[model samples]
Target: MESNENEFNPQQPNEHRPEQSAYGQPDQHVTNPSFKSKLELTIFSIEHLREIAKWSKFLAIIGFVGIGLNVLGLGFFFLLAPNMSPFAAEGLNIFAGFAGFIGFVFIMALYFLPILWLYRFGDNLKKAIDMNNSAELESAFGFLKKHYKYVGILIICFLVLYGLIIVFSMLGGLFAAMGTL
Candidate 1:
């Protein structure tokens, strides 16, 4: 049988097809149906990201140092609790111990988590930039999100606590004035 050059041979396939995507092996045409190109805005420069990472690393170091100092201070306070001061009020030492415990659980632990997140953000940002890995870059931003979310929550809690304290103090002052009258 003579081979017809006009007709495509069963053995030969079209080689001009667009490259397939990594996710689904779908051709470029299937993925992007609209011929219009999508444009994305760059809000920050890579230099800015690098600068932020550097600052975050520095802050993380400082936070870890502060946490270490707080732990040491708490331990020292407990160790010296029994040494009675002539000026100390009744049960002051016990109250201090309780306060220290609360500080360890609330302040120290809370501070530590964000510090770790900041540390991770800095580390991931550096690695992502160096290796040009998109996943790592996303991970770095996620750490930042976690850090901010935690801090915001803590701020809100503290604001509410302060508000309550102010309200109680005002009521106490009013009661004290009434008692004096």
Candidate 2:
């Protein structure tokens, strides 16, 4: 009986397999596909992600405070509007009062808008860290860098608007004084 020796050995290492082409010989027919050539891009680094997570609570707290302040401002305006001569004598018409309230609410939202992005950034960073996607982790850091400016803008706008409101209130007081005179 003749014994055949060509059968592949299961115990042999993959490197020694017959199917492997010549050493250092690139596959000419296999042009590199652009998609396959590169690894997936992620947003954040592990260190940055950990930092974000560490500070997430602080950001959340700041957001909560901002939201609370806005709510207080809204309540103050609503409570005072009815006592003012403009709305009081006019009976605070439903449509106009509602419109004004909406506008105030919109402005308040703008003031607290950074809180929204901060919350989102923290959440996304946490998720990326959990998923172990370094690229995504870096992306989250990039997002924070890009949007922090917007947050700053929101803060500045809120301060400016608040200043305007105070100026108008002072003017109103002056008019009341003139009326008394």
Candidate 3:
């Protein structure tokens, strides 16, 4: 049997068809869905994102708990250092302990920024999906972008720091060898 031109057929490609999406623009459905466009990600993939965000938010809260516990440890050690006798306290080097605590806290604060971003991303994503709010959805994705950007910059900073440490050590070694001669 011959198919009629007016009848819609799955086997036939219809390029001229104008299908409306949420807006009046033609619906752009991905034939090869290996990669999704932003529109597809925001609209169609929200359920997946919500699930991911739920888990991520849980983990970030757990991390915050871990940091709080670490603060207790810092306090414990800090308190222990000062209780020693005056001479012993000097030998114990409470200042070093204090410095270590400060440094640890500074690092933790740096890490907390990314965790905050992830938490915001997760919370906003969950809320946006529930409310079907575009503004909230955009905020969720913006936090995700900032999380990535901050992590990338942190990695670059660490690499540069490692490079500087290596160069300084090598120079120190060369200076020691010359001084020995």
Candidate 4:
């Protein structure tokens, strides 16, 4: 009779089996899949998570309020752009306001997603802690991941933009120097 690799041997329980792992059968693709989480959340960790949830919620609310105020300010700015004091040059008032409006809108659009993700993370974290539900905990973690991912991507974009600006500035300066010479 041929011995099956999948069958657990009760007689040789202490012997290391290539097919078995600490968490049952080993994944074929993952070599040495024995890393089990020993992290049993102590009181200190739970308390810290609670504090983080609270702070996240607080910051998210403040962000929302700031966004709301900025929106209101933009509306007023648009309404009063034409009535503003005349600039030294003609049509500069509307152009300045429009430029400001575009910049603000861009900033707000960038700001919104992370704030929303942060809020969801906080809300879900609170629910997870209160209800002790793994599903809610998973959801909270997902939101946190999304928030970080968005911020990371935004940071990369800003870095690229900064690099482009520096390159353009250097080129412009070189051109200006060449023109003078």
Which candidate ranks first by TM-score, i.e. highest?
A: 4
Model 2 is weakest, by summed lDDT over 10 consecutive residues, at 17-26
Please give, for residues 87-150, the per-residue lDDT of candidate 4 as tens digits.
5156676777677777887899899999999999999899988877655666788889989999
Per-model TM against the reference: 0.70, 0.45, 0.69, 0.73
- Over the stretch 127-152, how does candidate 3's per-residue lDDT look in tens digits? 87887765566678778888899999
* Global Cα lDDT for candidate 4: 0.77
Stretches of candidate 2 off by over 4 Å are 1-51, 61-86, 93-96, 155-181
Global lDDT scores for all candidate models: 0.72, 0.61, 0.73, 0.77
Inter-residue clash pairs, candidate 1? none
lDDT of 1 by residue, 125-161 (tens): 9887777665567678878889999999999999999
Residues 1-181 of candidate 2: C-alpha lDDT, one tens digit per residue: 7633433432333333223222223334533233222443345555665776659747767877877887777656655455642466677645455667778777667755566656666876877677765444555565576468887776798899999999999999999999998
Q: How many residue pairs clash in each candidate?
A: 0, 11, 0, 0
Model 3 shows how many backbone clashes? Answer: 0
Regions of candidate 1 where Cα sits further than 4 Å from its true position: 1-44, 84-99
Q: lDDT (0-100) at residue 109 of candidate 1? A: 83
